[model samples]
Structure formats: C-alpha cells, structure tokens
Target: MIDRRRVLKALSKYPVYSPPFHNSEAVLSRSEIAANYNYFLEQKARRLEFLASYLRHFFVELSLSPEALPALDNWLLRYGGHLIPNGGEVLFAMNDYEPAWVGEYHGVNIIHDISIFAGDYIVMKNDKVRWSVNYGDGTKRDYEEIGFGQPCLVGLSHFAYTGNYSIFHGIYEFCYAGLRRLRNGGRGSKWERDIPGELVRRLNYLADPDPPPQIPVSQLTIDD
Candidate 1:
C-alpha cells in the first residue's frame, strides 16, 4: 500500500524556497549563487541516480508490454479525482499545446514550442540539463536555470525549467498529490483551504512542507 503520510514527510525536506529576490545583490554573485547551486546540485546528485533508474526501468517495463500502461480513464480515476475538476477533467488536457524537435544540441534533444507561445527550446543531454535558451516569455527572467530554478529564490536571472516535457509532466503529478493532501483525508469533494494552500505550497517549491501563513491569504479574496 502507498504510505501517503511517509511520502509527505519526505517531501517536506525540500530546499528552502521563496519568491524571486529580484533586488538582492547576491543574485549577481556567481560565487554565492554557485554556493547555493552546489548545495542543490548535491541534493540532485542523490536523486539523479534513483530517477535515472526509475526511468530506465519504466521504459524497460513498457517495452515488455505496451498494454502494461494504464489507460487515460484509469489514470484519472487513480489520481485525477480532485486535481482536475472542470474542463481539466477531459482527456488530453494539454491538447492545445504542441511539442516539436527543432534540432539536436551536442547530441541532446532540442525541443521547441511552436504552436504555443513565441517559441523556446529545451536542450537536454541524457535525462538532465542545467540550462536552456528561453525566448518565449520576456516576463520570466530565467529561461536558463542553474538548477531547476532553485537559484531563482536568490533573484537569479532565470527560473529553473529543466529537462524536457518529462520534468514538466512530473510537476503535474506532484501538483496532483498536493491537491490530494489538501483534501480532508481522500474525500476531495471540492476545494476549500487546499486550493489556495496548494498554490502557495507550489510557489514555495515544497508541496508537502507547508509554508508560513502570515500575509498573502489574509489580504486577498476570491474576487481579487
């Protein structure tokens, strides 16, 4: 059986995260930022092996039998109950988006977004990468992240959007789990506290570890 509580406990230990400290002088210090980046790199070092193993095994299992893959209905029933409530409940929720392989970079996959926004590229070697060239949105500073946007907390130039679609897909799963936790037990009839809580939790970079509830929630209303 899945130990949800234990999973939450493990998730709580993610690195301390905050909004992009845009004005912080330390953002320019490659040395200081490098220090924090190294810390995050160390943490990633530990997870990389396990993730690689899991991905390798997943492909192996899928190759063994394509039928082993769960259908969309089963996927939703298993985890989509509360996360995707409305139009999101539909299959292929991201049908509006498209992924294109623009070219190869140093033998890595260079995926470009064509149909969506302006167009950005993700050049990933193997299963990981440290940076990319993001030309789609000028508002988001860090298209080239140091370590999955962990550096963004310090006012770094770019938020960390790493890997490829796989990593983005993984974030969706984590968000789903966060929504699951928000529900009182597994009964996610409707969103109450969990909606805002999940959003804030996602902002803080730790879905399991709760953030300090001191300011934002009190001032804003649904109408705002």
Candidate 2:
C-alpha cells in the first residue's frame, strides 16, 4: 500500500493558479510570461497530487485494492475528470479533443472515459439488469452490463429526461455515485441542493486549477 500522508503532502507542493493574462496587449516581458505559464503548469502538477490523495482515501475507505483504484482513476482522467497520481504507474488516453476523464496508478493507465457533456457517466458492462429511474415519467431502462472493468466508456444520455431539474439532478447523482464508487465504497445522499463545502473545495480546485503554459510572443513574425 502507498503512504497516503506522503502522497497528500507531495501533492500540496503542486502549484495552483488564478489568472495572469487578462488582456490581449498587456505589454508583458517574455520572462514574466514564461514565469506565469510555469506557475500555471505547477498548479496542474499539484492537482495531480490532490487527486492521488483523494484516491488513496477513497480506496482505504472502501477496502479496495490498489489495482482496482487505478481502473477508476483512468476513467476520471480520460473523460476530463480530475485526479492526480503519487509515485505509481500513470497512463493517459489521448485525442485531439478532451477526454471525459483519465486515471493513472503505478504509472499505468487503468481506466478511461471519453464523453462530451458534463452530465455524462460511463457504464462498464451490460448485465441485462433493470435500472431504477428517478424521473422522466418514471421510466426504467435495462442494460446488458452496468458497472466497472468491462467497457472503456459508456454514455449516460440514454438516461436523460426532458426537464431541466430531472436532467441536472439525475446527471449529478450519476457522477457522484460513479466517483464515490471509484474512491469511496458507498454513494452520497440524494439531496436536491448544493454539494458540501469540502467536496466543493476539492472540486473547485480540480476545475481550472492550472495556469496556461508560456509562449514566446517575440518569436512571432506576422506578415501584413
């Protein structure tokens, strides 16, 4: 087992950024821009640490093995889901477009989910099971396989409804359950309000946490 505390501590060193470039013409120097970009990259690097720590906690809490956790991590990263790695195998699924999430453990790519929407979730298998419905006229859908360790990615649009509340709530619930299962063992309570502060803090960092890489503005020679 990896040392959770060390992992978190290392992750803390990773950088976090706000914004350095506000306007198009700021009259900034190359060194300054480079510095800012470096800061941004550092922040992203730090996020990787945060992700690793969260995964460790989630795994221990759920009594899952290290092997099982990586599969979940890959799913998060490949699909643009945020999480970081400690000193383990790391792998990434790549494309011209953003992945739904990505995961890495012991430097190996274990899970990947590629989706376009925010309210998307991946179904791993088709077990022919009857799934419960929360809204959308109380309709139920059956699948051949649903869970983890089977498919590289699954779409959740099939579960969407017509109403905004139903769509948002259902998608939120689906993501929360998927995340919880990936790290923690159980699902969170079904609340129609906002997520808790702790979760928010973690997620906020995950969203737009890193700065942009610096580029040499002087190298450009525009032809008029």
Candidate 3:
C-alpha cells in the first residue's frame, strides 16, 4: 500500500534539477569547505539510519497488490526527469566513465561501479538516491543491473513484471551493503578520498532548509 496521493504531492514540489555549467562566485575557502565537510560527515549516522528506515518503507509499503505493475508505473511517471544513481550524474559527478570500487562478489569482481549521492535523501528536496551499486556485466537484470537505483521504482518495477520476490530482495541487500560500509567509514569505493570541495558547497546549499537571501560561509557551520 504505497500512499500514492502523498508521494505524488511530495514529488510535485521539486523542480527538475539542472546542473550549472560553472560557478563563477568566489569558492569557499579551505577552512569553510572543511567546516561544511565536517558537518556532512557528522551526519553520517543519521544518514545511515534514514537509509535503513527508507529501505524498509519502500519494501513494505510500495504496493504488494494484484495490480502492482500499474501501481509502480503511476509512481514512476511522477519521478520523471529524475535519474537514478548509477552511471548517471549523482550529486556533483557522473560516474559512468569509471568504476569507483571493485569488490569480490562470490569470489570474482562481480561488483563494478558504485555511486553514492551524499544528500539528505528526501524527495521533497529532490534527493534521488543514497547510493547505487552496478554489477560487472553491462546488462540489466533486476538487482544485477543497478543496485536499488530507485529502490521502489526499480526493484518493484521488475518484481511486478516477473513476480519474483528474490529479485527484489537482492536489490535491497545491495543497497543495505552500502549503508553498512558507510557506517564503517568508507564509501565502499576503491578510493578513500574526501568529497570534493565543489560538492561540499552544493550539499550545504541543498541541506539548508532556510537559506538566507545571500549565502555565507558561516551559515554552513554546525559548531560544537
């Protein structure tokens, strides 16, 4: 029983996101960026908790009825202009060109590219995906394709068509693994680097619920 009305109403508020070409304003200084980055990192626990709860919500609430296929399509239509996190642009970068991580899945490098959108993961704020894991093969096959790219839409869309519960479960597991890794302080990626400064600023802007008329570095801080 997906709350169709509530979800649609929430989706209506977000304008289609358009990435800027280049920002000409003076970039945040290293200290300012570090403050924002620290703030973002401090929220990792909350982010993981929200992800876990949302996964449960998607699984338990995204329609398990006779007319599941139609129900899924109705929601997918509302998600128009939103790209799932896969090879698509997530947060500040498009990860299609390279594999961010490589990991053994049942003995081989079955898992290929993994992308994480470091945002609040709120639809009203236009958050798309928390993270996505792509398998080695360049083909779509339920969970093997893109790991919970759009959880309910992607996973349930396949389940509705095939009527296979295992496919849906696999996708859930893939997404949960990302949350587990994040809790352990790594992005489940090959690189153990900090997020880029440009992305840090963008995230600060998005997370600001009441942004002032003009943005300032101090406003981005979450002091002790």
Candidate 4:
C-alpha cells in the first residue's frame, strides 16, 4: 500500500514551472534548466525509494522475487525518456531505450512510475512517446501511439494478475482524475486511468484457472 500521507506530501512539494508546451519552443539555457531539473529528479528518486519500501512487504507476503524492484527504481529515474544528472555526468543512456518525446519537447520531463502485477520488464524509447503494459504471458505490451507529446499516464492489464492489483482496481478513478486535470490545463495529468476496461476483462481471462473436462450429454441420455 502506498502511504497516502507520504504521496500527498510529495505531491504538495512537487516543483511547478511554466514553459511553452511544444517541442520546438525555445526556453532558457540548458545549463540552468538542467540544474533545476536535477534537483527535481532527486526528490522523485527519494519518493520512489519510499514506494519501493512499501512494495517490499507485498512481495514478501506473496513469496515473489524482489529482483524486479531495482528495475522499478531504474524505470522511474529514466521514465519518460529523461536522464538523471549527477555533476554533469549522464547516469544512463537515453538512446533507443528512451521515450520519443524527450528530445522533441523542450521543458521539464515528467516521471511516471509503473508497477505491473506480474512479469518483470522495462522499456525506454525516445522522447516522442512510449507505452507499456503486461500481456499476461511474461511478455509486456509496448508501443508508441499517435498524439505522443501529451502528458499522460496509461495503464493496461491483459492479465488480471499483472501490474499492481491495487492500481488496477483504481483505474477508473485515476482515469477520471487524469481527464479532469487535462481539461483544466493542469501542469501534468496523472494518467492512472487511461487503460481500457475491455483490456482488463481480457486480462482476467488469462488469470483464470484451467477449465474442467467436457462430458458428452449423449452418454447421460443412453444411461437413462
């Protein structure tokens, strides 16, 4: 369970800035902006640590391996195709692995932390766009949809047991909030609800137990 209080605290302190909302728009110096961006990233990194601790308890109870936790951390730091800065040294590569819109946009990058119920996977595309979801066969769904530059959070469940179950349950709530924020021109809309309900239904099928053997009705009639 994510600490509601902690998440609220982080959300309250999250930095705010106004920048032209286009990839080609010119802004301030890269050096100055980068400095502030690094500071913001540090705060996000700490918040991720908090989320990881919360997830650890769940993993232990389920007897699942915790190896995927580190990848989750890495995903957040580099999520949405932005690299973290440490004294001007790039900590990770944002090449084929980053979202497409990173270089296309000229402002502060957003961080989206995704936790799937099952499977261990990560993706990094250029800054233009990126998509990730669990398909229920140890394979993850990834793609770049049209209209990629918009700030959004998307979730998909092709298997009921995939991704964070709690998050899955709150999909509608998250989606409604995201849409509302987008309409109001909020800084960034939290995309918890962009997932399709149909997808969720299909995913439940993947998680279902094996079906029972079929019996011929004719055999029963003959016995009667």
Question: In lDDT terms, which candidate is top?
Answer: 4
In model 3, which runs have C-alpha deviations exceeding 4 angstroms?
Answer: 1-24, 60-224
The lDDT for every candidate, in the order shown, is 0.28, 0.28, 0.28, 0.30
Total clashing pairs for each candidate: 3, 39, 0, 24
Of candidate 4, the 10-residue stretch with the lowest lDDT total is 89-98
Name every residue pair that clashes in candidate 3.
Answer: none
Residues 135-176 of candidate 1 have per-residue lDDT tens digits of 223335443332222322111212332222233333344335
TM-score for each candidate, following the candidate numbering: 0.27, 0.21, 0.24, 0.23
TM-score quality measure for candidate 3:
0.24
What lDDT is obtained when candidate 1 is compared to the true structure?
0.28
Q: Write the per-residue lDDT of candidate 3 for residues 1-224, one digit (tens) a residue.
A: 13433433333322221122111233333344344335434543444443333333334232222233233233222221122232332322211212221211110011111111222222123332222222223334432333212211112121122221222233223443443444555444442112223223332333344444653457767441
Measured over all alpha carbons after superposition, the RMSD of each candidate to the real structure, in angstroms, is 17.2, 21.7, 20.9, 15.8
Off by over 4 Å in 2: 1-16, 23-32, 41-45, 60-70, 73-224
Candidate 2 weakest lDDT stretch, 10 residues: 142-151
**What are the per-residue Cα lDDT tens digits for candidate 4 across 88-183?**
211111111122223322111222223222211211211221223211222222212211222221332233322323322222233334335444
